[model samples]
Target: EHIKNYSKHIDEFRSQANSQGIWLFISTLGCWSVNIPLIQVIAAILLFCIFIFNSKQDMTEKRAFHKIEEDIAKDIDSNLIGDSRKARLYDLGLVEKYRKAIKPVLKTSPIFIVCYIFYSISFLVFFSNLFPRMKLIFNF
Candidate 1:
């Protein structure tokens, strides 16, 4: 069902968003050491950019799901079930609750976005060879 797909998309995007934060932080930390190599730094910068792009894609997907849910909710509420006042009211209330719950995402997402940008810039400046060196040091 469409609702099921909406839930799935939101869940998947949420995880992607979390990873954006984690990887950005890791990339920033990697740049802190002095002995990290150039290739490793380049790789980390590339990886961070990739993660940021993926996060943006995920956010777009999430917005699509949210819009779909809103449209479906509107369609259901606008037609059919002529006499089920209580049920319709309950559904409307639930929809409003869901909308409110997701509203904080608008605020929170920007903070994460800004943090990621700063992290990427810092990683490029201070840790260009950091990621490759990490692989050897961690024996990965």
Candidate 2:
């Protein structure tokens, strides 16, 4: 049961970590999609806020899992029999794999600030409102 909860927490944080990247991608694209700088900035800000919220959630889950892991370790038995023991070991491996997978993203999350800086610079350099010109270009 404890191992199952560990896997669940791992899964939860993995999605949370991925979501931060996904939203940041959308936010970056928003800068290019909209013509008006102010509106683009506003949309980017909102998307970044969502990304930040996910980061916080991921951190919280990480801490919770750590605490749970510590407590579970204290109570785990050395002796176990049959499939129950195999399942517990499998769950432990699964949880560890997910935790490892997300570690790189978490380590570099702050570096994403650099990405936003570059995105803003690009938005300024190539300022185009494609929506307004789409009809003329596409002959709709």
Candidate 3:
């Protein structure tokens, strides 16, 4: 009964963690699309913090779950070892789910990086051109 409850809890936590990761990935890339410098910086920082903290928490939970699996394995009968092993397998399944969920986000990062680089280059070009144009207009 306790094992069943633990399995359910692990599943719920895994799903939540995966969802958070997806959000983080989306927000990180979305930051690049933001034109306002101040807002872009703020949003990027917040999203970075969320990603880091959530990743740390996920690691902690995974370790704890692994420990629980070990303990349960030790306590159960030999015939039940198969069931105990299934719990460990479920942990791996959760990780794979997270990886699959996060894949699109991961793919977007390089695209965002290229876009940001291009944005910076264009901004520099515009500012350079604007300086000369402004001087010509003001006779400076």
Ranking by lDDT: 2, 1, 3
| Per-residue C-alpha lDDT of model 1 across residues 14-92, encoded as one tens digit per residue | 5566567776676666655535466566766676677767777756463555576677667666764666645655655
Which residue runs does candidate 3 get wrong by more than 4 Å?
34-49, 55-63, 77-140
**Candidate 3's TM-score:** 0.37
Report the C-alpha displacement of residue 9, candidate 2, in angstroms.
Answer: 1.9
- Point out the higher-scoring one by lDDT: 1 or 2: 2
| Model 1: lowest-lDDT 10 consecutive positions | 131-140
lDDT of 3 at 103: 66
Q: How high is the lDDT of residue 1 in model 1?
A: 42
User: Candidate 2 has which clashing residue pairs, if any?
Assistant: none
Every candidate's lDDT: 0.58, 0.61, 0.56
Error of 2 at 114 (Å): 15
| TM-score between model 1 and native | 0.42
Per residue, candidate 2 scores C-alpha lDDT tens digits across 1-140 of 77777776665655555556556766687656877767876776777677667688656454656677666554454656568766666667666666667565466454454555655555444443334444432232
What TM-score against the true fold does each predicted structure earn? 0.42, 0.42, 0.37
